[model samples]
Target chain A: MMVTLNDARRVIAAAETKAQEIGQPSNIAVVDAGGNLVAFARMDKAWMGSIDIAINKAFTARAFDISTEKLGELSQPGGQFFGILASNHGRVMIFAGGVPLRKGDEIVGAIGVSGGMKDQDIALAEAGARAF
Target chain B: MMVTLNDARRVIAAAETKAQEIGQPSNIAVVDAGGNLVAFARMDKAWMGSIDIAINKAFTARAFDISTEKLGELSQPGGQFFGILASNHGRVMIFAGGVPLRKGDEIVGAIGVSGGMKDQDIALAEAGARAF
Candidate 1:
């Protein structure tokens, strides 16, 4: 029915296994349906900066219900809802690496991970989701 | 035991599905451990403003271990940690929606989702997390 606590745990487990498989340390984070923190983790060699980035990605995906990539395209000049985020608030990063958690058309929550290249981060996150 | 990249993906998927089920057309966001933007999606008819706010929420969550609401509480004039975030950085929002990812005691990252009211924002984020 939702991205329950049990689901969150499953996501983390899968992500960890993927990170290890890739031979790269990582930091992963999870948020509730409302983007509230549910859990977190950081591997030994993960960059300190990656931790924050990972969390933001998860939140962004959950809040927007779309990939951060879309945000970038929309941010371009003449696009919709541009620069409004700056006026409304700060903390909007237009990169990539975060993904969402779902259950048959229902929004549950989201996850974010960092510690390697952008592609690696994305791969790991996707891997974690697939595992779940 | 901690949040992982896989965990990040699952969270977003759940959040997306929840928004759809609610019929609320929402904006969701996710971030990586470094607070970088990752995945984001805006429902077919979601508001333009709520989208960016969602991403920022995610970034804030990843950047701060505590919730954005907690960050707001700590932003007091003489709190243990004052406006240091201002001096240290420029884009840090303190509000709800953003939350951390964790595995046991570990912190992987976090997530943030918007669209819908503040309570709604939090509600959906939680739902997505649970679903995943």
Candidate 2:
């Protein structure tokens, strides 16, 4: 199944709630199974630069079918995917803040968050993924 | 050969000059023959949202070997290439402000401009392409 706009909205709402709870304005994005953007929101005062980063993070997560946190580890120097970030026309984001949405064993979509510290972004993204 | 950094700078500078003359702060980008970004500049007070658009417009021009303005016409509803924007991982921007850079009938690169109206962006991109 694909990620519907309605599904993306619910995920974004949950991430927004978590961001509010943590007192961090964030940019959140959702991508469908085809890695196309489904929904996005930039909370007031969120970093403008993070808009691209948030969308690409979700694309990277769904493209590789892995959490961006794990991808970041593997993409570090001396790791298997060390140069992968340069492969996707600069769209791959090897960092925290991206989590895949799964339906059973199938990846249905992904969520990405930005405009906060790495930990905060990860937490917010995971919160969104869980909502999915 | 691909577009060199020096050439990209010259193109951006020319575009910036034109933008200044027209009183429109803008985002400008250049891509090499391989469709990789060579350079980019966002003028003071330019819309952050145009950064991605500027870069992708350059990419689209080079990818199609035609101006995005022309492509936009063919991509309109009921046109032969309608719905083409849904391709290219959402990077194909079928709109104004993208112009191919040519050398002796060979397309060597492209320039993209944004953060202004359609005519302004087109004029700015043309200025950059002329420089190239």
Candidate 3:
């Protein structure tokens, strides 16, 4: 089935809370198993172009089945595609803050937050994810 | 809820299987609730230009709360200033083949695939998504 609106609201709520707690604004995105967007939020003071980055992060996570942060890890100099994403379309954000969603061991969707420091963004996303 | 690691694996597995099944090499992307890159794969014969499109599809999914196909639909005619949006950094592939993830009634993340015809790509991605 498609990702329901209810989950989209939850993701946004959690993102807001985490962002507020961190005192950092961000752009949050949520999509379904088919990689379709279900919800999104661009908080005040968030980065202008971050929406693209956030979405890319989430997309990367779901597409590769790994953490965007990990992509950063592998991106270290030469780890395969390292920067290949950038070369491909130039919107790859290997930094932290992008995460995935699941239902009983199934990655039904994902979330991406942008604007704050990569580490902080990741922490906030993780916090929000755990809350659900 | 977050797109769990399990979801990433499923996305990748399904993508690869579908690509092979279709006799088409493809680039697939999956993002988390946070819009992070969860999983990605570039089939041996997939077009290099397609990777970014695949990931962007997933990213857009998480960022816009809509389908890339729908986004394309909006780009047509004068729906919402159409072409004006393309000015925003432009890598917008409003084509199909991108879908989202959900748990019950929540959108956890999304998935995107590229390389084959847009419709075929979306169909393959959908096949993979349903497998989950």
Per residue, candidate 3 scores C-alpha lDDT tens digits across A47-128 of 9899988887776666666678887888877687666565536656687877877777877777777888877888767765
Question: How many clashing residue pairs, candidate 2?
Answer: 0
lDDT of 2 by residue, A1-132 (tens): 268899999999999999999999999999987576899999999999999999999999988999999999998999999999888788999999999999899997899999999999999998998888
Chain B TM-scores of the candidates: 0.76, 0.98, 0.88
- Stretches of model 3 off by over 4 angstroms after superposition: B1-132
A74, model 1: CA deviation in Å?
A: 3.2
Instruction: List candidate 2 stretches off by more than 4 Å.
Output: A1-132
Score residue A97 of candidate 3 by CA lDDT.
78
Model 1, docking class: incorrect
DockQ of 2: 0.03
Using TM-score as the measure, which candidate wins? 2
* Cα TM-score of candidate 2: 0.54
Backbone clash pairs for candidate 2 read none
* CAPRI band for model 2: incorrect
Q: Number of the top candidate by lDDT? A: 2
TM-scores for all predictions: 0.50, 0.54, 0.52
lDDT by residue for model 1 over A21-123, one digit each (tens)?
8898988887777777677889887899877778877777676666555665665433343332352344444556677777778656778887888778788
The parts of candidate 1 lying over 4 Å away from their true place are A76-89, B1-132
Candidate 1: how close is chain B to the reference, as a TM-score?
0.76
Categorize the docking of model 3: incorrect
B-chain TM-score of model 2: 0.98
